[model samples]
Target: EDKVVQSPLSLVVHEGDTVTLNCSYEVTNFRSLLWYKQEKKAPTFLFMLTSSGIEKKSGRLSSILDKKELSSILNITATQTGDSAIYLCASNSGTYKYIFGTGTRLKVLA
Candidate 1:
């Protein structure tokens, strides 16, 4: 079965701190890796990584994928309390279906 794993399952940091979240996967006929941030009920799309050596950034959040290592990383810089959320990583292949990883829960304290 294709699998995705994320490290440091949970984190707690002060309002101005930075955090790095990690994800690694193994899939057959690989397609892409996607990142999402879940704050309440729904998860918002963060990044879609299809090519290596390319970094995708939005505001204080950034992510990159490394196909050779079958891994990806998400970095959040100067995080605010509003940044607290569960970060999810998913992989897709063949049919637009997604295999998700166990999420990383982040708590940014004021």
Candidate 2:
């Protein structure tokens, strides 16, 4: 069975703090690892990493895939109060279906 797990289900951090979120998966034929950030409306696409070790970055957010370990991590640096959101991780198997994690809720206080 294909499945994904995200760590630290919830977190509280002060503004300017750096946070690392983890996601691990087990799939039949792994294709890619995906990251998303969800606020009030819809989830926004963060990154899709097919190659391991190479980090993807946008603004204060970055993510990396570890194919050998079947895992990935999302890092947020200099977090701001507006950075508070639910972060989601998904593993896409070659079968074209994605196994999503329950997500990690992050709260950033000023």
Candidate 3:
């Protein structure tokens, strides 16, 4: 069976704290890894990685994919209350089916 797993299902931190969220997967012929942040509106796309050893970043958020380990990491540095949201990790294989993790709920306090 194919699946994606995310660690530290929930987190609470101060405004300036750094947080690392993990996602591991086991799928045949993995194609890509995607990250999203869900807030009051809808889930916003954060990144998509098709290759390993490369980091995709935007502002205070960054993510890396490790093909060998079949895992990915999402890092948020100097977080703010506005950064609080439910992070989602998803993976797809050769087929067009995506398997997603339950998500990591992050709460940044002021």
**By lDDT, who's the top model here?**
3
Q: How would you encode candidate 3's per-residue C-alpha lDDT over 1-110 as one tens digit per residue? A: 99999999999999999999999999887899999999988899999998998999999999999999999999999999999999999998867799999999999999
Worst 10 residues of 3 by lDDT: 91-100
Q: Candidate 3 at residue 39, lDDT?
A: 92
Per-residue accuracy of model 2 over 2-23 as CA lDDT, tens digit each: 8999998999999999999999
Rank by TM-score, descending? 1, 2, 3
Worst 10-residue lDDT window, candidate 1: 90-99
Candidate 2 lDDT (Cα, 0 to 1): 0.94
Clashes of each: 0, 0, 0
Cα displacement (angstroms), candidate 1, residue 71, comes to 0.5
lDDT of 1 by residue, 2-95 (tens): 8999988999999889899999999998899999999888999999999998999999999999999999999999999999999999999868
Kindly provide the TM-score of model 3 when superposed on the true structure, using C-alpha atoms.
Answer: 0.96
78 in model 1: Cα distance from truth in Å? 0.2
